[model samples]
Target: MFKVEAIADSYDQRVVDVDTGVYLEWLVTGSRYTTEVFNLVHPGGMIPFTTSREYGVDPHTGLPFLVFRFITFGSAVRAQLRTKHLINCTFTDDLAKKFWMTVAAEALVVFGSAYNGFKVPNRRYTRVEVNEKIYTLEDFGYTTSPG
Candidate 1:
C-alpha cells in the first residue's frame, strides 16, 4: 500500500500596477488560504509548492501586464511513487501528479480573489513542473521592474 500526503508549506503573492504605481507583496505560512488550497487539491496529503504573480511595465516593451508562475518540488518522490506504486490499489502516482497539475492549472481560480484588476498574461508564461532546485526572485528578474 502506498501512503501519500501533500501540504502547502507556504503561500505568497506580489502585484505591481505600472499604471498606478501600486505594489503589494505578502507571505502566509499555514494560513487559512494555504490550508484551503491543500484541502481543495491534495486533501490529506502534504507537499511543497510555489505560486507567484508578477505585474508591471513589461521589461522589453514598457507595457502594463500580469504574469503568473508556478513550481512544485519533490520530483524524486513523485517519480518513485509513479514507478514503484503503480499497483496494489492503495495509492497511485497519478494522484500525486494530478495534485500539482491541478494547482498549476487552477491556482488563479483558487487564489485570484485578492487581485481585482490583474489578469492572466495573454502570452505564454513560464511554468516549471517539478523543480529540483528552488528559485529566487533574482532568478526570475522580478526585482528589476517598476511596481
Candidate 2:
C-alpha cells in the first residue's frame, strides 16, 4: 500500500509599493495541493485571479494526473507587489517521495520569482500510517537542483 500525507506550510512578507505598505500571506494545503493568496493590507479578503491548468492522462504512461495550474493575480492596489502568480503541480502515487519533494521546491521558486526582493520559506511533510503505527518525514531541501 502506498499512503502518504503532505502539508505545504504558509509564509508572510511585508511588501511596499513606492509609499504604501501592504502585507501578503500565502497559504497552501490539501492532498492535491491548493494555494490561497491573501492581501492582509486591504480590508477585503482574497483577490480575484485567473486560473488555468493542463491535466489529463499521460499518453505514454496512461496515468491520470494534473500537469500544472497557473494562477495570475494583481498584487496590492498600491504596493509594488504587482502581478503575483503561482504554478501548482500534482504528483501521483507512482512517483517517489523525493521526486515530489523536488517538484514542490520548483513550484516555490516559480511562485516567488516575481518578487525576487522578498523571501518565501516553504516546507513539505510526508506522513505514513500503517496499522496504527505512524511515521513522519520532512523534506527541506532537494537532493538534486530542481532546475
Candidate 3:
C-alpha cells in the first residue's frame, strides 16, 4: 500500500476600501503567516506609506506614509517578506492586450495540465503572467505594510 500526504493551510479575509482609483484601509484576518504576507503583498498592488516618524508625511513625494512593524513567532522567521507577483486585471493598453493573451495561454496551460491529469500542488495556482514584472500595492496606492 502507498501512503499519500495531505497538507492543510488556513485562509482569512479582509475588507479593502476602493476609492480615488487607489486603496485605503483594509480589514485583515488570517494566520500570522498569511496575514503578514498578505499585508506585505499590499492589497491594492501598491507601496505602503513611509515617513520619518511612525506616521509622518513624506517630504520628497508629499504623500503620507506609514512605518509598519510586525513580529512573528515559531523559528525566529522574519515576519514581513513580500511576494513577487501581481494578480490583477488592469494594465496599460499595450500590456492589457498582451495580458489577455497571456491569460489565454495560461488558461490553456491550466486546462492542458488538468486534462493530462497532472498533479498540481494543492495551494499552487497557475495564472497569467505580465511582463515578468512583479506588481506591488504602490502601483495602485496602498500604504502600511503588513507584518
Candidate 4:
C-alpha cells in the first residue's frame, strides 16, 4: 500500500528546501535559463546565497587581488542597478531564481492537490492482468510518493 501523507510531506519538504544560489547567479548574469528551473533542486526553503561574485588568485603569489577587484566592481554594479542608472535591465540571476522558486512552490501545491481524496492501500497487488481487471477503487491507487 502507498501513503499520501508521507508523499505530500516529502514533496513539501523538497519544495521548501530547494536551493536557488546557482540559479540566482545565472539570472543576474543574463544567461540562458535551463530546465532545472523546477523547485525541487537543492538547499530547500529560503533563498540560498543572495550574491555570487567570483574571485581569482594570482598564479605567482596565490593571492586574491583579482577577486577583491571584482568584488569592488560588483559593488559598483549593484549601486548603479539600484540608482536607475542601469535601465531596461534584465533580471539578475537572483531575481530569476526567486521567480522560479515561486513558480515551483505553486507547482508543488498542484502536485499535492492532484492526490487529494486518494485512499491508502493496506496490501500489495501482484502484477497480473486478471488481478488488475478485477480490482476496485478500494483495491487500488493508494501508494504514496513516499513510503
State each model's C-alpha RMSD to the native: 14.9, 16.6, 19.0, 21.3
TM-score per model over all chains: 0.29, 0.23, 0.19, 0.18
lDDT of 3 by residue, 1-147 (tens): 011112236242222222223222122223431232212122335322111112345466565433222222111112122323323234457764554333222222222122210233221221222355422233323232222
Question: Worst lDDT window (10 residues) for model 4?
Answer: 65-74
Q: Candidate 1: what lDDT?
A: 0.33
- Candidate 1 per-residue lDDT, tens place, 1-147, comes to 001112237454334323433232222323333311111123243333344445456568555544444433322223233344211112358776664444433333312334332233422232222234323223333333222
Q: Where is model 2 poorest over a 10-residue stretch in terms of lDDT?
A: 117-126
Summarize candidate 2's per-residue lDDT along 69-142 as a digit string, tens digits. 32434332222245344222222453443333333323332233223211223211222222233222133333
Give per-residue lDDT, candidate 3, residue 61: 57
- Which stretches in model 4 have alpha-carbon errors above 4 Å? 1-92, 117-147
**Cα lDDT tens digits for candidate 4, 1-147:** 222233253443222222332211111321221111121223433232122222344466554321100111122243344343322223367666445444333323222212322321212211111211322223344344334
Clashes of each: 7, 1, 15, 15
Q: Once all C-alphas are superposed, what RMSD does model 1 give against the true structure? A: 14.9
Local distance difference test scores for all models: 0.33, 0.30, 0.27, 0.27
Looking at model 4, how many pairs of residues clash?
A: 15
